[model samples]
Structure formats: C-alpha cells, structure tokens
Target: MRIYKVGGAVRDRLLGIPVTDIDWVVVGATTEEMLAKGFRPVGADFPVFLHPKSGEEYALARTERKSGRGYGGFTFHASPEVTLEEDLIRRDLTINAMAEDDQQNLIDPYHGQRDLEARLLRHVSPAFAEDPLRVLRVARFAARYAALGFTVAPETLELMRQLSESGELEALTPERSWKEISRALMEDQPQVFIEVLRACGALKVLMPEVDALFGVPQPPAHHPEIDTGAHTLSVLEQAALHKQPLTVRWACLLHDLGKGLTPEEEWPRHIAHEFKGLKLIKAVNERFKAPRDCQELAMLVGEYHTHGHRALELKPSTLLELLQSFDVYRRPQRFEEFIAACEMDARGREGLEERSYPQADYLRGASTAARTVAVQPLLEKGFKGPELGEAIKRERLKALKAYKEQV
Candidate 1:
C-alpha cells in the first residue's frame, strides 16, 4: 500500500504555514491489511486508522456517493481499487484535495496548487454541493486565508448559495453547526465568516436573529456605520484585533440583536434594546448547545453591555449592583471577558475603533476596590446572618462611593 500525506497538512505546507497535524490516505489498502500492519482502527464512519508509532490519522483512499439529503446522507466506498485521484476529487476545496507522496512528490490532479497560487478557494468538483457542511467549511477557509488575499471563486459561491436555498442547512445538527462556527470565530477574520454566511443566506436559516440586524437602523451619531449589521461585524472585527477569546468574540457578535427588533417608529433609536436582546441570545445559545461559559458571558453582555458603556455615569449604588450582578469577586475572569466584549462594542462604531474605552479600566478598578471590602472586619463587629450581609453591602458601597469620588 502507498500512503500519501493529504488535506490540511499538505495545503498549509504549500502556503508556507506551520503544519499542525498530518493526515494520510492509503491507496490500495484494505481494512484487514491495515489491521495486519499494526494500525489501530478509529474511524466511526469509514475506514480510518492510527499509526502505531506517530498516532496520526490514516484514512483509506475512498469515494463517496450522495445517497439522500444533508451531510450525513452519504455512502463511502473504500477498497483496494479506489484511486488517489478519486479520493482527492471528493474533498470540499481544491486546495485541500492535493496530496503528497513519501518521496515528497506533489499530486495535483485537481490543480490545487494552481488554485493555491491564485489565492482562490474553489470547489474540487460539482459534487461539492452534495454536502451542506461544505458551505460552512468554505466560509471558514475564507476566514482563515482572508489575510493571505484569498477569495471564494464565484462559481463556488454560487454553489454555496444554491445549497443554502435547498433547505439542507436546516438539517445540520446543532453540534456539527457549532463545531464549524466556533472554529470560524477563532480565525483571524471571523467577520468574514459572517459575511460569507450572509452572502449565501445561511445566516438567515441558521441564525435569523443575527440576519435580522442587517437592514436595521441605528443612530448615526453613536454608530457612524448607521447599519446595525455593519456595526455587529465591526464589533467582531474589533474583538479579533484585540485577540479576545471566543467568549468575548461571541458576545460582541450578538450584542446588538435587539436593535433589529425595535419598532419602525423608533427608527434610529433603540432605547431598551439591551433588555430586548436577552431572549434572542438565549435562543441562539440553546440552539447551538454552546458551552455554558460562552452562553453565560454572552447573556451577561447582552443584558448589561449598555451599563458597561455608561460605567462612569452610573450611581455608586448602581455600580455596586452591576458588580454584584456579575459576581466579580468570585468570577473575575468572566468579568474581565465581559469588559473586553463591551470595549469591542464601544469601539465597533465607524471611525471610533481607535478611540479609548476608559469604561473598561474604570469598571475593573471598581470591581477591585469592591472586592477588597473585608467580610471578616464586618463579622468582627458582631454582625450576624442578615446583619452580616447588610454590613458587607454598606462597607462595599462606602468603598465604591469613595472610589467614585477619586475618579
């Protein structure tokens, strides 16, 4: 059997990127033969094994047939007769379809190298439309290579649009959808992911809450971009620029959903959009089965991001209440993440990206000062039960009042 290094490792190597993992495709190999050679079976859907020494994944060269609808409705055929070319043609993107032999000979039956040089993300074949997941995958690749000047081929984008309109995207499981989305959010240009999805209409299907924001108007004075959707994308871009974590990035993306739900008469104003956005954020979190930390942070940001923007204007009691709401003393990291998300929101407006966000430092300092209020001191004064809680609140408020005065 001849083994060829395939997929991302080969693609990234051609792009002069540091390859993180290597996947191999074995031509002219049977499952029995792979097992006899000491490879451990690990694939759940098809014939895949792990090298006994390196533990890298080795999948048999295979061809797939679309048996029905959605991504899972496929039958894979793997045998000694399956050619390397046949396996390569089944990949989603041409750049990912190339392979390399042990002698380092490049195999480009699909001209993946040519597409790579052109900085284009093109489909391997017309068969690309058979899997709905490819739409998300292509968008993710767009996000990854956006810095490298890559653009999705027009034909491939048309195919993606067709797939989006085919009702197939609705068939994707929450786990699978989130897998692609979470990965895209970590990419360097995650805003492009949303743009691509919106272009293909998948955002309307998978995340209508976000889709609804596109045409929604906002006060031009606060948001020079004017379009709420444009503002959201700007926020995501800011989060990326700041190198914020996934939780913060996600919060920035969904922070303005309530703007879309405002009455037309409200026009440029969304007075209580923060309160209105909580349900939409929760729905998105539940639909994606997002991690608890991500969901929790998103919810907090949705409900109180305005409070963060107005940190200096809030009364000392209100500031203390906001700190207590976030449980800043016990969960300081999450509080930090919330501040980062709020900073992204404040900076997302057109022409405001480089503007200072003193609210973040102010709130952080407030949390720190409030956290220093000693419960032991209050208890030593013979405060007990309800009295102890009241005394601690009084001291924390007093400290915040003094802190506010200093600011």
Candidate 2:
C-alpha cells in the first residue's frame, strides 16, 4: 500500500503557511489488510483508520456518487482498485485536491498548483455541485484567503448561485450551517463571508433577516455608509480587526436587524429600533442553535447597544441599571464583550473607522467601581435576606454616582 498526504495540509504547505492538520489517502489497501496492521478503525460509514502512533486519519482512496439530497446524501466506494487520481477528482476545490507522497513529490492531476498560483478558488470538476455544503466551504475559503488576494473563479461562483437556487441549501441542518458560519465569523475577513453568501443568494435563503438589510436606508449623518446592510458588514469588519472573540463577532453581525424593519416612509430614521431588534436576535439565535453565551450576548447587544453609545449622557441611575442588566459583577467577561461589540458598532460607519470610542472605557470603569462595593460592610450592619440584596444594590448605586461625579 502507498499512502499520500492529502487535503488542507498539502494546500497550506504549498502556500508557505503552517500546516495544522494532516490527512492521508491509502491506495491498494483493503479494510482487512489495514486491520492486520496497527491502524485502528474509526469511520462509521466508510473505511477510515487512525494511525496507532500519530493518531492521524488515513482513509482508503475512494470515489463518491450522489445518491440523495443535501451534504450527507453521498454513497462511497472504496477498494484496492481505487486510484489516487479518482479520489482527488471528487474533492470540492482544486487547491484542496492535490496530494504529496512520502518522498515529498507533489501530485497535481487537476492543476491545483496552477490555480493556486493564479490566486483563484476553482472547482475540480462539474461534479462540485453535488454537495450543497461546498457553497459555504468556498465562501469560507474566500474569507480565509482574501488577504492573499485570492478570489473565487467566476464559473465556480455561477455553480454556487445555481446551488443556492436549487432548494438544496434549505436541507442543511442548523448544526451544520452554523458550523460553517461560526468558523467564517472568526476568519480574518469575516465580512467577506457575508458578501460571498449574498452574492450567491445563499444569505437570502439561509438568513433573510440579514439579506433584507441590503437596500434598507439609515440616517447618513450617523451612518455615512447609508445602507444598513453595509453598516452591519462594517461592524463585522471592525470586530475582526480588533481580534474580538466569536461571541463579540456574532453580536456585531446581528446588532442592526431591527433597522431592516424600518418603514420606508420614515426613510433614514429608525426610532425605537433597539427594542424592535431583540425578538429578531432571539429568532436568529434559536434558528442557528448558537451557544448560550453567543445567544445572550447577541440579545444584550441588540437591546442596549444604543445605551452603550450613549454612555456619557445617561443618568447615573440608568448607568447603574445598565451595569446590573449585564450582571457585570458576576459575568465580567461577557460585559467586556458587550462593550467591544458596541464599540465596533459605533466605529463601523463610513469615515468613522478610526474614531475614538470613550464609552467603552467609561462603562468598564463604572463596572469596576460598582464591583468594588463591599457586601461585607452591609453584613456588618446586620443587613440580611432580601433587605441585604437591596442594601448592596443601594451601596453600588451610591458608588456609581460618586464615580460619575469624579469622571
């Protein structure tokens, strides 16, 4: 049997980037023969083995046939007779289809190296349309390599558009869809992911709430970008630029959903949009089965991002209430993330990308001051039960009032 290193490891290696994962394809190997060696069986549907020493995955060279619908509708055939070229042709992108031998000889039956040099993401074959997941995968690759000036080939994008219109993306489970989306959000250019999805019509199919924002108008004075959709993407861009975590990035993406619901008669004004956006955020969270941290932070950012922007002007009582709403004393990290998302929104407008966001520091300082209020002092005064809780709140508010005065 001959084994060749395949997929992302080979691609990243060619690009002079650090290779984090390594997969193998073994030609002229049978399941019984693999078992006779030290490899351990791991695959549920096909013949895949884990190396006893390195624990890396190794699968027999195989070919696939589309048997049903969605990403999981494939039937596989793996045997000693399957060729490496056959296995390579079935991959989604040409750059990912190349392999390397033990001697470090590059195998490029599908011109993956040529496409890589061209800075293009091209499909390996017309068979690329069989799996709907490739649409997301290609967009994710676009997001990942956009810094390197790589773009999807026009013909490949046409296929993606066709797949989007075929009703196949609807069959994707929320778990699978979210897996791509969350990964894409954490990429260096997260907004490119959204742009690619919108270009291919997948955003309209999977996330109509976000897609509807494209043509929606916003006050040009506050949002020089004018288009609400453009503003949302700008927020995502700022979140990525700051190296924010996934929860913060997710919050940035959903913070302006209510703006899409504004009446055209009202034109650029969207009064009370913060209150109108909470239900939309909850719906998106439930639809994608986002983690509780992501769900809660997104809702908080949606319902009160305006408060964050107005931190300097709010009354001391309102400031204390906002801090209490975020539970700053208990979940300080989440409060910090909320502040970051709000700052991203404030800075996301056109020509405002470099503007200062003093509100973040103000809110953070307020949280620190309130958290420093001693509960032990209340206990010493004989406060207890519900009365103690109320007393502690009063002292925290008093501390915030003093902080407001000094700052």
Candidate 3:
C-alpha cells in the first residue's frame, strides 16, 4: 500500500510558500485496515478518518453526486466504483488537485503541475458548474493567490459565471454562505475576491447591500471618482495592507454600508449615518451570525462615529471619564476594536485623504495613544484617592486648555 501527501499543503510547499496544513491519501488502504491500525472512524457519512497517533486526517478517494441543491446537494461514492484519479477529477482546480506520494513521487494525472507552472487555475472537469459553492470558492482562491498574480482559466471563469446566474449557489444556507464569506473576508486580498465576485455576479445574490455599493456617490472633495462602495473597498484594502485582525477588518468593510441606504443631501448630511449604521450592523452580524464581541464592537463604532465637539474639547480626565462612562473597559477587546474602527471611520473618506487628515497622527498619536500618568505618585502626593482622581481629572483639563491655547 502506498500513501502520499496531497492538496494545498503539497502545492504550497513546492511553491516555497509556508504551508498552513497537511493532508494525506492512502492509495490502497481500506477503512478497515485504517481502523485496525487504531485510527478513529470519523467519516461515518463521508469516508474521512483521524489517525489516533498523528491526529492528521485521512480520507478515502471518492466521487460526488449532485443529489441535492446548493452546498448540501452532493452525495459521495468512495467504496469501489471510484478511483483516486476519478476523485481528483471532481476537484475545483488543478492547483488543488495534485497529490504527492510518501516517496516524494510527483503525481501528474491531471497535468496540475503544468497549470501550476503556468500560474493558472483550471477546473478538473466541466462538472464544475454542478456545485454552486464553487463560484465563491474560485473567487476566494483568486483573492488568496492574488499576490501570486495568477489568472483563472477562461473556461473556469465562464463556469463560475454560469453557475452564479443559474442561482445554484442561492440554495446554500446562510451558514454555508457565511463560511465562504468569512474566509473571503479573512483573505489577504479581500478586495480581489470582492471584485471577482462582482465580475461573476455572485455578489448580487450573496450580499446585495454590498453589491449596491458599486458606483454609489460620495462627496466630490473627498472622493473624485466612484461612490461610497469604492471608498469602503479602499478602506478595506488599507486594512489588508496592515496587520489588523479579522473583526476590525470586517468593520472596515461594512463601516460605510449605511451610505448605500442613505438618501442624497448636502455635504456630509449623512449625519444620521451612524444611527442607521448601527441598525445595519446588527443585520450584517446576525445575518452572518458573527461572534457576540464583534456585534458590540460594530455597534459602538456605529454609535460614536459622530463623537462631536467633545472629542476635540474634552479634557483627558473628562476623556477618561467619558471612556469609563461608556464602560469601555467592560470589554477590553471591544476597545481595541473601537480604535481599529476609528481608523476605518477617519480613513474611509476620500475627502479626508485629499485633505491629508494626518492619517497616522489622527489614528495613533491623537486618538488611541495610551497614557499612564503616574497614578501611584498622584495618590501618594498628599491627595486622597478621590482627590487624586479629581487631580488627574484636572490634569486633563490642563492639557485640553493648552490645546485650545495652541489652536
């Protein structure tokens, strides 16, 4: 019996990219042999198993049936009728279809190596249109590998477009859609995926609110070309260029979502945008079933985007009081999130960029900088704790006063 390494783990290794996971294929081992070897029977419905000693997964090569609709519509056949070559035939792309034998022998049954050399993502078979989920998956691969600068094979792209228009993917439950959407959001080049989604027509069905953002207008001074949708994607691109975490990036993607639903008025009449934004935030979070902490961070960002003159006028003590008043510390993770959101809010506008809103100074130097301010010394210096806190309060007043004098 010969076993081999397979899939992205092998492909990534060959390309010298850091592999994120490892997969294996045993060409001749039966499930009973695997079980006899103490592997756990984990694929009662699917033929996958987990080795007791290694914990890595192993699955018998299999083929699929378009038995149902959407993601769940597929049925599998792995017992005898299908071979490893047949299983590989149903895979979405050649780059993902090749396998590696334990002896490091290269398996090129589908010429996947040639496609990899050519930087192409070609479907294994014309059957790509049978599953709607492949549309998003291919788009996601584009995003993930956008840096690699490969192009999707023309036939594969056509298949994606056809499947999307056929509404086959619409049968996917919110959970399944969320799976791809969440991964797409987490990708290093999310905008690439989004643009590809738009190109393929999947965006319209997957997220109309976002799809509607295309060509939506923004203030002329801030954004010279395109509308609010373009601005949001730009912000998302900026977030991607940094090390900001997933939830923060998600906020950046959705921060200006309200603009799509808001009617036109004067410059920045989108004053009520934050309130409307809060409601929309809930819908997005609930629709995607995002985590609880993410929901709070989203709403807080939506609420304070209009932070007003107090932001410019408040004393540091008052600022601390204000921060404490909102119980911001109740969720420290949420506070870190708010800073990221603020970066998005302040950076999301083209007008702000045009004016050179002192990008770094605004987000890092001014808004989110941490101040320790000798707390123990203030308490030790003849003032009671309350008095000391009040003194710290006064210290903020002094700072704000100095700021006003400078201004």
Candidate 4:
C-alpha cells in the first residue's frame, strides 16, 4: 500500500502555515489488510484506522456516491481498487484536494496549488452540491483565510447558492451545524463567515433571526452603521479583533436580535429590544445546542446589555441589581465576558470602532467595589440568616454609591 499525506496537512504546509493536524490516505489498501497490520479501526462508516505507533488517523482511499440527503446521506466504497485521485476529487475545496507523497512529490491533479496561489476557494467538483455540509465548510474556510485575501470563487459561490436554495441544508443535524458555526466564530474574520452565508442565501434558512437584521434600520446617532445587521457583524468583528473567546463572540452576534424584531414603523428606534432579543437567543441556543456557558452568556448579554451600557447613569440600587442578576460574586468570569460583549457592541458602530467604552471599566470597577464589602464583617456584627443577606445587600449598595460618586 502507498500512503500519502493528504487534505489540510498538505494544504496548510503549502500556504506556509503551521499545520496542526495530519491525515494520511492509503491507496490500494483494504480494511482487512489494515487490521492485519495492527492498525486500529476507528471509522464506523469508512475504512479509517489509527497508526499502530503514532496513533494518527490513516484512512484507506475511498470514493463516495450521494445516496439520499444531508451530509450523512452518502455511501462509501473503499477497496484496493480505489484510486488516490478519486479520494481527492471528493474534497470540498480545491486547496484541500492536494496531496503529498512520501518522496515529497506534490499531487496536483485538480490544480489545487494554482487556485491557492490565485487566492480563490474553488470547489473540487460539481459533486460539492451533493453534500450540504460543504456550504458551511466553505464559509468557514472563507472566514479563516479572509485575512490572507482569500475569497470564494464566483462559480463556487453559485454552487453554494444552489445548495442553499435546494432546501438540503435543513437536513443537517444541529450538532453538526453548530460545530461549523462555533469554529467559524473563532476564526480571524468571524463576520466574514456570516457575510458569506448571507451572500449564498444560507443564513436566511439556517439563522433567520440574524438574517432579518441585514436591512433593518438603527439610529444613526448611536450606530453610524445604520443597518442592524451591519452593526451586528461589526460587533462580531470587534470581538475577533480583540481576540475575545467564543462565548463573548457568540453573545455579540446575538445581542441585537431584538432590533430585528422591531416594528417597521419604529424605524431607527428599538425600545426594549434587549428583552425582545432574549427569546431569539434562547431559540438559537436551543436549536444549536450551544455550550451551557455560551448559551447562558448570550442570554445574559441579550437581556441586560443595555444596563451595562448605561452603567454611568444607573442608580447604585440598579447597579447592585445588575450584579446580582449576573451573580458576579459567584461566576466572575461570566461577568467579565458579559462586559466584553457589551464593549464590543458599543464599539461596533461605523467611525465609532476606536471610540472609548468607559462603561466596561466602570462596570468592572462597580463590581469590584461591591465585592469589596466584606460579608464576614457583617457576620461578626451579629447579622444572621435573611437579616445578614439584607445587611450585605445594604452594604454593597453603599459601596457602589460611594464608588459611583467618586468616579
């Protein structure tokens, strides 16, 4: 059997990027032969094995045919007869279809290297439309490589449009869709992922809440971007620019969902949009099965981000209530993430990206001041049970008031 390093490991190496994972494709190898050689079988639907020594994945070269619908609706054929070219042809993108042999020979059957140099993400074949997951995969690649000036090829985009209109994207499982969404959000240009999905019409089908924001108007006084959708994407861009974590980025993306729900007559104003957004955030969270931390933070930011923005004007009682809602004393990191999301929102507007967000530091300082009021001191003063709770609340409010006045 001839083993060749393939897929991302080959592509990333060619791009002078640090290759994180390596995959091997074996030509002329059968599953029985792989097992006989002490390789551990791991793939349930195909002939994939872990190396006997390195524990790296090495799958026997296989070809697939579209069987039904969605990503998992494919049947695979793997045997000694399967060619390396056949396996490479089934990849989602041209850049990923290249391979490297043991002798350091580059296999360019589909001109992947040519497309890579052209900074285009071209599909390997028309068969790309057969698997709906490739739509998200291509968008994610666009997000990852956008900083490098890479864009989806026009023809490839048309195919993506076809997939989006085919109603096949609905066949994808929530878990699988979330995997792509979360990874794309963490990429260097997370907003590009959303933009690309929108360009191909997949966003409307997969994330209607987000899609609805595109043409909605916002008050230009606060958001120079004007369009709610543009503002949401800008917030996501700010989150990525600051190298914020996934929870913060996800929160920023959904924080403005309520604005999309605002009535057309309301125009640039979205009264209580934060409250309106909470339900949409909950819907997205439930649909994608987002991580508990991500779901909780998104909900918090959606419901109370306005309170965070109005930190300077809120009464000490209101500040304390906000902190209590966040349970800042117990889950301090979530509070920090909430503040980060709010800051991203504040700075996401056009010509306002570099503007200072004093609200962030103000809220952080408020939390600190409230936290400094020692519960132990009250306990020593004989405050007990509910009385102790009341006394501590009173003390925290007093501290917050003092801190606010000093600022």
Candidate 5:
C-alpha cells in the first residue's frame, strides 16, 4: 500500500500557509488490511482509520457515486482497485484535490496547483453539483481565503447557483449546515461567506431571515449604508476587524433581521424592531440548532441592542435592570459579548467605522459597579432566601445609582 499526504495538508503547504492537520490516503489498501495493520477504524459511513502510531486520520482511497439526494446520499466504494486519482477527483475544490507523495512528488492530475496560483476556487469535477453541501463548503473556503485575493471561478459560481435553485439546499440537516456556518463565522473574512452564499442564492434558502434584509431601507441619518442587509454585512466586517468571537459575530448578523419586517409606509424608521427581531433570532437558532451560548447572546443582542446603544441616557435603575436581565453576576462573559455585538452595530455604518462607542465602556463599567455590590454584607445582616435576593438587588441598584451620579 502506498500512503500519501492529501487534502488540506497539501493544499495549505502549497499556499505557503501553516498546515494544521494532516490526512493520509492509503491507496491499494482494504479495510481488512488496514485493521490487520493496527489502524483503528473510525469512519462509520466510509472507510477511515486512525494511524497506529501518529494517531492522524488515514482514510482508504475511495470513490463515490451519487446515490440519492443531499450530501449524505452517496454510495462509497473502497478497494485495492480504487486509484488515488479517483479519490482526489471527488474533492470539493481544485485546490484541495492535490496530494503529496512520500517522495515529495506533487500530484496535479486536476491542475489544482495551477488554480492555487491563480487564487481561484474551482471545482474538481462536474460531480461537484451532485452534493448540495459543497455550496456552503465553497463559500467557507471563499471566506477563509478572501484576504489572499481568491475568487470563485465563474463556471464554478454558475454551478453553485444551479445547486441553489435545485431545492436541494433545504435537504441538508440543521446540524451539518450549522457546522459549516459556525466555522465560517470564525474565519478571517466571514462576511464573504454570507456574500458568496447570497451571490449563489443559497442564503435565501438557508437563511431567509437574513436574506430579507437585502434591499430593505434603513434611516440614512444613522446608517449611511441605508440598506439593512448592507449594514449587517458591514457590522460583520467590523466584528472580524475587531477579532470578536463567534457569538458576537452571530449576534451582529441577526441583530437587524427585524428591520426587514417593518411596514413599507414606515420606510426607513423601525419602531420596536428590537422586540420584533427576537422571534427571528429564535427561528434561526431553532432551525440551525445553534449552540446554547451563541443562541443566548444573539437573543440578548436582538432584544436589547438598542438599550445598549442608549446606555448613557438610561436611568440608573434601567441600567441595573439591563445588567440583571443579562445575568451579569452569573454569566459576565456573555454580557461582554453582547456589548461587543452592540459596538459592531454602532461602528458598522459608512464613515462611522472609527467612531467612538463609549456605550460599550459605559455598560462594562455599569456591570463592574453592579458586580461590586457585595452580596455577603446582605447575607451577614440576617437576610435569607428571597429576602436575601431582594436585599442584593436593592444594594446593586443603589450602587449603580451612585456610580451613575459619579459619572
């Protein structure tokens, strides 16, 4: 059996990037042979194994045929007869189809290296259209390599558009879809992921709430970027620039969904859109089966981002209420993520990228002051049960009030 380093390890190495993981393809090897050699079988749907020593994944060279529908509807064939070239041809992108042999020889059967130099994301073969999940994978690759000036090949984009129109994107499981989406959000140019999906019309199918924001008007006075969808992308861009975590980035993406639900006659003004967005966020969370932390932060940002923006104007009691609503004492990190999401919204407007968002610091200070209100003192004074809870709230409110006066 001949083993070759394949997929992302070879792709990243060719791109002058740090290779994070190594995947091996064992050609002319059967599952029985692999097991005999002490390679632990791990792939339930296909023949994949962990190496006996290094513990790296070593998948037997396999070929697949479209059997039914969606991404998982595939029949895989792995045997001593399957060629390494056949296995490479089934990859999603050209750049990822290349492989490196033990002798350091580059395999370029599909011209992957050429496309890599061209900074293009091209499909390995026409078979790419068979898997709807490739749409998200392509967009995610676009997001990851956007800073490197990569663009999807025009023919590849047409295929993606065709896939989006095929009604197959809806068949993907929520868990699988969210896996791609959440990883894309953590990429360097996550907004590009959304842009690519929208370009191919997959966003409308995958995330209609986000798609509805397109062409919706917003007040030009506050959002020089006018279009709600454009504003959302801008906010996501700012989140990337600030290196905000996935929770903050996700919150920024959904924070404006309610603006799309506003009446046309109301035009650029959206009254109580914050409350309206809560439902949209819930729908998104439910559909995607998003992580609890991500869903919680998105919901908080949706319902109270405006309050965060108006922190300086809120009464001390109101500020205390907001802090308590976020449960800052128990989950302070999520509150900080909420503030980051709000800051991204504030700075996402055209020409306002560098503008100050003192609201973030204000809320952070308020949280700090509220947290310092010493529940121990109340307990020591013989306050018990619900009475202790009431005393703690009273002291926190009073401390916040005093801090507000000092400010």
Candidate 6:
C-alpha cells in the first residue's frame, strides 16, 4: 500500500508556512490490513488509524457517500475499490485537497496546486454541498488566506448562499459550529470570517443577534466614520493588534454588540449596555456552542463592567470589599477571567468613548494600595482553615464598609 501526506500539511508546506498536523491517505489498504500492519485502529464508524511508531494519523483510502447533513451524517467506504482521488474529492477546499505520496511526490488529481498558486479556494467536487460545515470552514480559510489574496470560487460562494438560505446549516450542532468559529476568531484577520459569512448570507443563520450590528447607525459626535458594523471591525482589528488570547479578543468583538439594539436617540442610550452585552455573550455562546469558561468570560465582561479598576484602588480593607463585591473567594478563576475581559472591554471602547471609564479612574487610585500590602501572603500569615476563613471575612467586611465611606 502507498501512503500519501494530504490536506493542510501539504498546502502549508507548499506555501512555506509551518504545518502542525500530518494527515496521510493510503491506497490498497483494507481496515484489517491497517490493523495487521501495527497501526493502532481507532474510528470504527469511519476508517482512521494511528501509526504505531510515528504516532501520526494514517487514514484508510476511503470514500464517502452523503447520507444526511452537517459534518457527522455520512457513510464511509474503505474497500479495495476506493481510490486516493475519491477521498480528496470530498474535501471542502482545493488547497486542502492535495496529497503527497511516500516518495514525497505531491499528488494533484484536482487542480488544488493551481488554485493555491492562484490564491483561490474552490470545492473539490459537487459533493461539497453534502456537508454544510464546509461553509464555515471556507469562511475561516478566507480569513487565514486573505493575506494570500485568495478568493472563494464564485460557484462555491453560490453554493454556500443556497445552503444558508435553505437552513441546511441549522442542522449543525452549536458545538461543531463554534469549533470552526473559535478557530476563526484566533486568525490574524478574523473580521474577514464575519464578512465572508455575511456575503454567503450565513451570518444571520447562526448569529442573527450580532448580525444586526450591521448598518446600525451611530451618532455623529462620537463615531462619524461608519456604522456599528464598521466600528466593530475596527475594534476587532485593534484587538488582533494586541496579540491577546482568543477569549480576550472575543470579548472585545462582542462588547459593543449591544449597541445595535439601543435606540440612537441623539446621545445613545446604552446606560446598561454592559448588562445587555453580557446576556448577548451568553446567548451567542449557547447558540454557537461555547464552553462554560468561555461563556463565563463573556458574561463577566457585561456583569463586572464597572468594577475592574475599583479593585485596584481600594484600601486593603476596601480591596477586600471590592473582591467581595465580585464574590471572588469562591470563584477565583472566574473572577480573574472577568478582570481580563474587562481590561479588553475597556481598551476596545476607550478610544470611542475617548473619556476615562469608571474603572480607569479607579485603577489609578488602586496603585497606592498595591504598594502597601501587595506582597503580604495570607497563606503565610499563620491563618488556616476556618480561622483563615474568619480572618478573611473580617478583613473583607471592614474593607467594604471603609470603601463605601470613602466613595
């Protein structure tokens, strides 16, 4: 049996980009033959195996017939008749459809090489429509390859539009959809994903809430450049510029999503836009199948919009109070999550507001407290168990009362 390196690794290798995953396709290997040859068999429903020594994946030369919808609903055949070409034909984009044999000779049954050279992404075959998840994949690829000057083939875009309008994308589990979106969010120019989805008419299919951000007008005094959509894109660009983690970046993108739902009555009434923003974050996460921690990050951005800087400024007594306000002791990691997201949130909106958010001023005052007791470790202070508990409670309450009096 002949083994061929396939998909993204080949594409990345050709592009002189660093590749992380190595996928291989084999011709003339049956499932039993693979197992007999010391490959640790996995994927019973489909035909995939792990190479014993190399630990790299070596999938059987298999073919698929579309049966249902989304990504999972398919019937695969790994018989002697299946050719390597048949496997690549079902791939979403031509760049990902190329393969390389053991001799390191690249295979290009489809003109994936031509498309990659041309900076284009087209489906391998008409079978692309069998799985709607390809639309999101293509959208992500558009963002990643945008610097390559790649464009989606017009036919592929048309097919995506048809699938979206027909709601074939709706069959996708929220988890699966977010898996693609989360990866897309990590891209350098992720706004392209949103734009591509909008072009394909799939944004409304998955994210109707934030999709409304488009064309939503902003007042002339603060934002004369463009609508909320434009502003969000700018914010996303800025967030990307910071080289922050995906969670922080996502909060920046969604922090202003609530503005679209607010009435533009001259001054822009987003008094509790933070509150609305938090709910939308949860909704978006649920709709897109985000993890609990991710959902919490989004919620914390909205819920703790006011108190980030306040934590830094308080007297040790007052600092305890502010920490208590967030109920931090029981949820340390989550509270820290809120702090990180709030920093991103403020940074995203700071320029547009062009004025100090409440937290900014509070943070300025907080530096003094940091100078004093910042190094005092509570664990080393001879406090343990419920005694540790009572001391903390006493200090926190005193801080809260003192902080309120100062305000």
**CA RMSD, predictions in order:** 1.0, 1.0, 4.5, 1.1, 1.1, 4.7
The estimated TM-scores of all candidates read 0.98, 0.98, 0.82, 0.98, 0.98, 0.82
**Pairs that clash in candidate 4:** none
lDDT of 1 by residue, 11-95 (tens): 9999999999999999998999999999999958999999999999999999999998887999999999999999999999999
Candidate 1 lDDT score at position 69: 83
Mind giving the per-residue lDDT tens digits that candidate 3 earns over 99-146? Answer: 887778788688888888888878888878898888888888888888
Looking at model 4, how many pairs of residues clash? 0
- The residue-by-residue lDDT of candidate 5 on 1-407, one tens digit each, is 99999989999998899999999999998889999999999968999999899999999899999998898999999989999999999999989998899987999899999999999999999999999999999999999999999999999999999999999898899999999999999999999999999999999999999999999998899999899999999999999999999899999999988998999999889999999888999999999999999999999999999999999999988998899899999999999999999999999999999999989888999999999888777778999999998888888888888888998
Question: For model 2, how does the per-residue alpha-carbon lDDT over 1-407 read when each residue is reduced to its tens digit?
Answer: 99999999999999999999999999999999998999999968889999989999999999999998998899999999999999999999999999999999999999999999999999999999989999999999999999999999999999999999999998888899899999999999999999999999999998888998999989888989999999999999999999999999999999999987888998789998888888888989999999999999999999999999999998888998998899988999999999999999999999999999999999999999999999998999999999999999899889989999999
- Per-candidate clashes, comma-separated: 0, 0, 4, 0, 0, 4
Per-residue lDDT tens digits for candidate 6, residues 302-372, read: 56545574454545665555455545545655555455555544444425534345654443333323223
- Give the Cα-based TM-score of candidate 2 against the true structure: 0.98
What RMSD value applies to candidate 6? 4.7
Runs of candidate 4 with Cα error greater than 4 angstroms are none
TM-score, candidate number 5: 0.98
Write down the lDDT of every candidate, Cα atoms only: 0.94, 0.94, 0.70, 0.94, 0.93, 0.74
lDDT of 4 by residue, 301-393 (tens): 999999988989999999999999999898888999999999999999999899998998999999999988898888899999999999999
**Residue runs of model 6 more than 4 Å from their true location after superposition:** 224-226, 264-268, 306-407
Error of 2 at 150 (Å): 0.8
Model 5 residue 157 CA deviation (Å) reads 1.0
